[model samples]
Target chain A: MTATVSYVPAPDAAPRSRMLGAQTRMELRLLLRNGEQVGLTLVVPLLLEVFLNLPLLSSLGGSRRIDFVVPSVLALAVMSSAFTGLAIGTGFERKYGVLKRLGATALPRSVLLLGKTLAVLLLEVLQVGLVCTLGLALGWHPHGNPIWTALLIVLGTLAFGGLGLLIAGTLRAEVTLAAANLIWLVLLFAGGIAIALDSYPAPFADVARYLPSAALSDGLHHVLQNGGGLPLGAALTLLVWSAVALPAATRWFSWE
Target chain B: MPPQATHAILAPSRPDEAASGPALEISGLIKSYAGRRVVDGLTLTLARGEIVALLGPNGAGKTTTIEISEGFRRPDAGTVRVLGLDPLRDAAALKPQIGVMLQDGVGAYTGAKARELLDLFAAYAAHPHDTAELLELVGLSDVAGTQVKRLSGGQRQRLSLALALVGRPALVFLDEPTAGMDPQARRGTWGLISQLRADGVSVVLTTHLLDEAEQLADTIVVINHGRVVATGSPAELVRAGAEGQIRFRAPAGLRLTSLSDALHAGASASEEAPGRYLITGERSPQLLASVAAWCAAQGVFAEDLAVERRTLEDVFLEMTGAELSA
Candidate 1:
């Protein structure tokens, strides 16, 4: 070995935007590759949409049942990917020390979170496309502007994504796994996604309206089903949830 | 590996920030967990291009110290500077310059293939080593398509090492870099680390292997009870206070005051056990000649006479009061 010491120069960090794009692309690929996530994010929502539209399961009792089923199933898909899927995957990542390892890298925490958000949004786009195509095949007729539905989906994603991170970051992996699944089931049955809010008693219906899932379902229902303008109350409910949950998650989230 | 290949793989992208200052500096660092002080007033410094190994028993605060240096944990007191900038406050700037190889190889996404994981980490830097070349360098090319979780323990470790070097970092903090590796792989890693130094990259590694520290480190810091018990180069440490010894198998009771008188001052001879004699003194040709002459006069041949020098392990055990491997 030569005694001559040649100093290697220090490397600069890649552009932050490029790093973010790479991270988002990697995350989306992993999400798509995971069989269980694919089942939850894509297959489960499609099956539910099909089963709910069946003649025996149709409680609305009309040719317009697909209208109600399509919007509500879209809301459910958002929750599945943004809340349930993100929570379980992130919890395990934390348990396995992946987040702690990334914490030491040049990648900033904001970039990590943004990359995950972008990935979730991208996955939601695919889910929405699948659900809408399945709805169209089932003879569904939609109404109102699509822009309002996009707004509702975006806000609903942020609200649910924040809560998912909050649960995943604060709880143990096993606990997060159970809690996230349990919450998904409860919201699916009672939060006005599969079942209309009016089907419940008046008091329970009023309270469920504030739940993020119910708010998203109600907003999407009004816009697509009733051909209404922006549902101010439902949108505000989701906005408030995001304002509270995102900051809280940011404050309390632990990398390890 | 050829020097040219090593140079191409590890060459830095720009000149260092401060060419003359130490690569890392820590002073009066204090950290506690659950009211128990783990790092108590610890201090250390590494000159540019020097490799320093932190040697300690389990729970001796080695990991905590390194984590503090890496900006993973905030010290309760004192400060740490990497590349002349605070580790925590300047982390955004410092992270790009320093590489960290964690103890458990926990950074990569387990579901991603080995090559994909390396490529992802490489994308974080402007000038990263080629992913294919890095996999080849770490002897992981055969398993490049294997998922991270499917790789063996040593393979995962090599992958972790490749991640740390992908960014062309100026300094690297490695925690037990060769743990769980076979002897041949361990030697290969040692050579790579030496090459890192020849490229003027500074390193701070923690190891339980005493011989590893002695062989690779420019300075060895022995920590016990969250404090530095001893710090010096390997040779300086072994030669500090411990003297060499000469042992032989001979008649037990044959050693009388005659041997003591025959030898020079500050030297002593004793029969530690039956048929075994021990002598402690500064070892030299004159000392050996005197002992041989004394044995000739006493009509006793020194059978199996062996000269021994104090090793770094002996120095470590003497200071830390704990087994090196513990």
Candidate 2:
């Protein structure tokens, strides 16, 4: 409570997008408010990068250590914020009747989707910023075009966010809770986040490049490591994943 | 007190100005799941500014009916109109004018503070009440910054009520509006509900508290087996059966043969306690006189003479043949 708690009389004339904007703001506030969520999404990536970059403590080595670890953490950050966090939160929202109640409100389902997507995008920006600042502080110089780096992060957010929706929107909360953490662990280790695909056997590395997590990490690694102007292959892979997962999530999503 | 006295309790100042149309109208609503009819051919109407309570036993489809009317669930047959618009097809247009207090969760983000949640919901409305005033209205002004998950049960109930009224909706749906409230909180909520009606907001609530329905609802709808079993004002419902009773305390061991012969043929009287007597029969001026005559003839001073008129509880029991909480 505060002296400034005075509120405006709500107008009956606000458009759908305005309602969506308010919802997105509230969602972002809530995501940031949860200490556990912040720990998993924001802090974990920073810690992982630091540990992975240390030659004495890290299995990763030598000249490419800084380059490899920084982009990988960025990808890991997107997965944490958009994929793991989004899925668990939404699954519980569905379980707790929050989604059911919102369904009764003036905001349409499309607006709810847009609001959540917007909240994820906003958080992703914060996540990228934190990872980049930490990477720069650790003496990891960027080699990629900033514009493409930004574009890849956006596409990567959408692609992983869609899969998160697919999981949260379809599964029961308990199962979703277990499966989201499980999927995140699997992606972090085998999907080419913690370790490089180049170290894998040729057959496995080929499969890893097709994974959304790998595409994001690989694309960011190349551009940021070499100042590459465009990451067309990684960009196309992310776009295709987005195209598939988004429509599929939309088709499968259930409000309650 | 007799049920008839309830009619004049408030002396409803505004001569029931007929609303433009019923705020909510449902006819032949039928909903089934897996070939079982959960809401079967139920119909009820709620007029503007009126408080109608849905009373029933458990699994009686009270929630199902409210859900269909709110457009959260679809009915297999029949139609529902909220503010003269289809609840489902015109939901986007109709929602702003309607407030719903969900029976669980208060529909809030667990991590969001109470004040933040109220403000967030306010922004979704075309016209919403001031968040501060709304919070104060529901007595949640003190806990504005408390996270939803951190609120007490009664506090959460109040918060849910505030969320519903924040939009100043023309019509509202409250499912068990005072289920977890303490006695004081319950009365406070009742006062707020009366105020909502005074402001011309229609209310439809489901409740297990018989006194709650009697005290608040202008009309009560009782459902059983997924169908409307009874619909009437409290007074009217009480009078439906028209069986009144007389109770008195007196010396035990009074011979019943004379008393039985002196009364109407069908009347039955029984001593339920050592010195207590109950007489069940048609309650009329003549029956009271006859009972008085019997007491005088027996030369017994019948202390604590009491007349028990049929009440809404009796009507509900007779209709559903089950407890309200069953």
The docking quality of candidate 1, as DockQ, is 0.51
Model 2, runs deviating above 4 Å: A1-13, A56-62, B1-19, B249-261, B264-277, B282-285, B299-304
lDDT of 1 by residue, B1-326 (tens): 23354455454333465566799999999999999999999999999899999999988999999999999999999988888888889889888888889999746689989998888888888777778887888899999999998998999999999888888788999999999888999998998898889778899999999989999999999999899999999988999987888888887798558898888888888888998888888888877888899999988988999999988888888898899663
| Shift of residue A234 alpha carbon in model 2, Å | 1.4
Query: Per-residue lDDT for A182-214 in model 2, tens only?
Result: 988998988987887777789998988899999
Please give the lDDT score for candidate 2.
Answer: 0.83
RMSD after CA superposition, every candidate: 3.0, 6.2
- Model 2 lDDT tens row, B1-326: 12233223323212242237787899999999999998999999998779999999888899999989998898999989987878889777777767889887487677889999888888887556678777887788899989999999999999998888776577789999998889988998888787777656789999878899999999999999899998999888887767889998899977777776777977878888888888888887777788889999878999999999877778788888998762
Error of 1 at A231 (Å): 1.4
Docking quality of model 2: it rates as acceptable
Tell me the TM-score for chain B of model 1.
Answer: 0.92
Q: What's the TM-score of chain B for every model shown?
A: 0.92, 0.86
Best by lDDT: 1
